[model samples]
Target: MSTMSAKIVHISIDRDWREVYGYASRPQNMPFWASGLAFGLMQDGDDWIAEGTLGAARVRFTPHNDFGVIDHRVTLGSGLQVHNSLRIVPNGDGCEVMFTLLRLPGMTEEQFAADAAHVLRDLKTLKELMER
Candidate 1:
């Protein structure tokens, strides 16, 4: 598969990487930081259902791991699937949470930029919640 344009949006959290990962990796905890899922998610089998602007999306999160990987795949109501790569890695006394935003096919420059901004906002929210 050809690589698409991608941007790594990240934020530093003043907390242990393991602690950050433990809280952030759970699908049930996402509504606190991920604005799109403000109403929270409902478990449907192994995938989670989150209602967004476009409609319900089926999100499948990666299994728990020691490497701090919290990747997920989202299948929108329209059947458009977006794979997200997220990670929490140690940075001295704190940690860095990173999200890889990819420019999908037919995405305009403005839309891609908006998506990056959205991801950044979510990460910032996570930082705030963890630091408090």
Candidate 2:
């Protein structure tokens, strides 16, 4: 399995990072900023399942944030697996949010890089929205 990770720094903690994580982690919020082609959210028992189209591939979000991990599975098309994690640490005047995404076998490095960039952008957007 191929693995890739990226980090974003120097963000003010004016809003709860956890909440930001929750929002970004939601499926319905994808169309707001995610570069995905399509997105949807559905209830599966108690947990919400987030599904979206990233290009021609279908991706699913199975949140495990309670354990500081989020699992993403690409079922249709290019089958892939992603384990996501967000780490928040206080910096000088704000907090640093670090995102780690591990790509499982069948995923390309380019795809991971693109996803990481999109996620970082989404986090920045989330931070801005919460600070407002």
Candidate 3:
């Protein structure tokens, strides 16, 4: 197994956990903000697929629950599985949304940084959309 590293990015939202999770947990709502998945998701059995900027990817998101977890697994067309660990937690006066970018094997530092930036922008978009 290849070792992996993570870069954690987050934003504090001016909303309750339930509200935040309700908006973010829907896979169909992804393309509206997540640039990496600009094409959104298409349901295919128990999994969802996206013909996204990164290419065709099949995704499996964590089951719905009241805890505000939004984790997901993505299998790229190249067959590499990327795990995205995301969460929304109650904070004073609001909630905080966190996204963990896992650095996969063979990814260069520059690529990793770019990917992190992409995720940050996506999170910001999510925040703006939800807070609006």
Q: RMSD, each candidate, Å?
A: 1.1, 4.7, 1.0
* Model 3: pairs clashing at backbone N, Cα or C within 3 Å: none
Instruction: Write down the TM-score of every candidate.
Output: 0.96, 0.53, 0.95
Model 1: pairs clashing at backbone N, Cα or C within 3 Å: none
- Sequence-dependent TM-score of model 2: 0.53
Stretch of 10 with least lDDT, candidate 2: 1-10
Could you give candidate 2's per-residue lDDT for residues 1-132 as a string of tens digits? 233444443345565555655655666675564445235555565444455554344455564455423345544444553445555544554455566655545558887777667776766775776567
Instruction: Name model 1 segments beyond 4 Å from true.
Output: none
Runs of candidate 2 with Cα error greater than 4 angstroms are 1-13, 16-38, 55-79, 90-94, 103-110
lDDT of 3 by residue, 14-115 (tens): 888898899889998989888878877899998999998888999999999888899999999989888889999999878999999888888899999998
Off by over 4 Å in 3: none
lDDT of each: 0.93, 0.54, 0.89
| Per-residue lDDT of candidate 1, residues 5-92 (tens digit) | 9999999999999999999999889999999888789999999999975578999999999999999999998898899999999999
True-vs-predicted CA distance for residue 34, candidate 1, Å: 0.6
Ranking by TM-score: 1, 3, 2
The clash number for model 3 is 0
